[model samples]
Target: MDKTPLTDPALAQLFTQARTYNSWSDRPVDDATVRQLYALVSAGPTTANSHPGRFVFIRSAAARARLRPHLSAGNVEKTMAAPCCVIVAYDTRFHEFMPQLFPSRDFSATFAGKDAVIADTAMRSSTLAGAYLILAARALGLDAGPMSGFDKDTLEAEFFPDGRWKANFLCNIGYGTDDQLFPRNPRLAFEQACLDL
Candidate 1:
């Protein structure tokens, strides 16, 4: 397969067009799209390939209704208006999957009985997966709005009380409206943000 140039007009636009969309069209995102996004994101890297992230997508009115009370007032309307909302969560027992997912050696035993290590690894790796979700959505021509404005404890109790799953963040996905976007903001230059060493 031929690779497109980095300077290709379409590729350039895709990079520039990706934005945090706060409002969406009335259109609905199909389940297949959600699955495709997961399939794409799962291929991204993780610590020891542990693949700690788990996603619970809420598209039905009933599911979204369950999420409503947990969201801050500022987030309630936009979340409801979105075609789909994804609950990006981490598994507290992600090490159990290491045998199947990592498959190189049995690393699961190393994490057993270590609560602090488990929590640290799970949150960091799952957050990376959440970032992968946003990029994958952009690649698929979808818009996303990711926020941390919701109540985590309320969310966990309402959605994941089994103690196995921990909430990371919430992202609303759909076709975005330009009217809802603010002007582009400044970003630090590479020289200012990166270190060669």
Candidate 2:
């Protein structure tokens, strides 16, 4: 595949002009678009291709009601107003799929008895997938508001009662409104945030 820089508009859409929205328009994200978003997100690389992320897209009134009690006070209104709220989660038994994901060799045993390694890998990779989700949503002309302000324990119990998947974060998705937006914040310059090594 030939690698080329993305067009300026694409860059702006995915990063420069993209904002974490707080208000959503009445427009809804259709199921087909959500499916496309996942197809893009799943293609992103993960540690040993562990691919641990599991998403629960809350689009119904009943699902949102179930999630409402778990959100922080500040996040409640915007989240409930959005057309969709995605529960970005990680699978605890992610390594079980290693044989299929990393078929060149047996990598599942590396995480079999090591609880710490399993948790760490799953969390890290799932978070990467969450970031991919945001980018994918933007690429598809959807808006995103990713937040961590929620009751983790209660949310996990409420959404993942089986103890298999754990919530990583929540992201509200839809057509967003700038009515509730604040001025764009500054980001660290390369010199301030990176090292030449």
Candidate 3:
């Protein structure tokens, strides 16, 4: 298998040049693209293949209106204006799927009666899946604005009525413009962020 590196342009498009957008154009993100994004992102690996992540794409004015009251004041306009806003959540009963995801053995027993273990995997693995979604969206020529400025409890009550799933974070997706971007923030060097140990 070839281990060829990505081209500079591709790297820039997905990482170096990617920005958390606050403003988007009038063009909308079609449903087909959203489904394609999910298919591409679902291939990403997760702990125990828990695959707890679930998403609610708020593309309609009525749904966005329902989501508005849960958001922080600062996040209101940006979220409502984006072509699509996603409610990234996790399933508390994720272990139920373990027999299918990790079918080599019966792993569901590991979390059968453990609520804490279930919660931990739900949050951690869902977050990883959310990251995969963001990257997949970028690769498909879209921008993602991942944020956490919302009331999780309120969102869950509004979106997840059965209490089966819980909100982790919110992300607005679209083709962004430089108009709302603040200056690029500084990043830590590898020496500052990592340790050999």
Candidate 4:
């Protein structure tokens, strides 16, 4: 039997050093890489495994143009310069897939006609998936910058006019530049941040 090397202190640093990168090198992130990241992220857990998140990767100048007007001033330069910017969205009608996804029972009917509940569930689940995308990207040796500074209404209208997809967040992915990093910030110790019941 082939045994894999056990995870240890050095492996922990790989996760610890993963930070939100704001600047990227001129290198490009190809479509294949983006698809691979999605394939990895989709396997992460969600409530009932609903898998509501949908990603729209904008790599061309034209698609990036549609995003510019909605971006916050601070996010414009870095986001535009990145090789690919992913629009993480949630499907409002995701419950329709519950029968195929969850399988035990048909749960679609519970949310089919309830707009508020549907929106709430979809947004929460998709946000969790988006976080998974960031972590998966890091594990794959890619730098990620996840931001929430865009205008959601304008983004939805411009990118998903049919009302099926609602914008959640944006993530810029590529090779990062050392010149763009700020000094590492301090983190709370376990005793200060967590409490045992």
Each candidate structure's count of clashing pairs: 0, 0, 0, 0
Q: Which candidate, 2 or 4, would have the higher TM-score against the true structure?
A: 2
What is the per-residue lDDT of model 1 for residues 1-197, given as tens digits with 9 covering 90 to 100?
A: 99867666556445665678899998888878999999988999999998899999999999999999999999999999999999999999999989899787989567989999899999999999999998888888888899998999999999998979999999998998987788879889999999998
Task: Highest TM-score: give the candidate number.
Answer: 2
What would the TM-scores of all predictions be? 0.93, 0.98, 0.97, 0.90
Candidate 1 ranges beyond 4 A from true positions: 1-7, 10-14
Q: Per-residue lDDT tens digits of candidate 4, residues 1-197?
A: 99886477435534667778889998988878888999988899987888889999999999999999999999999999998899999998888889889898878667878988888889999999999888777777788899999999999999999999989999998888877888879999999999999
Tens digit of per-residue lDDT, candidate 2, span 1-197: 99999999999999999999999998889989999999999999999888999999999999999999999999999999999999999999999999899989898579989999999999999999999999999999999999999999999999899999999999999999999998998999999999998
lDDT of each: 0.90, 0.96, 0.92, 0.88
Q: Considering only N, C-alpha and C atoms within 3 Å, which residue pairs clash in candidate 4?
A: none
Clashing pairs in 1: none
TM-score of 2: 0.98
Evaluated at residue 127, the lDDT of candidate 2 is 97
Reference-based lDDT, residue 134, model 4: 87
Cα lDDT for residue 29, model 1?
A: 85
lDDT comparing candidate 4 with the true structure: 0.88
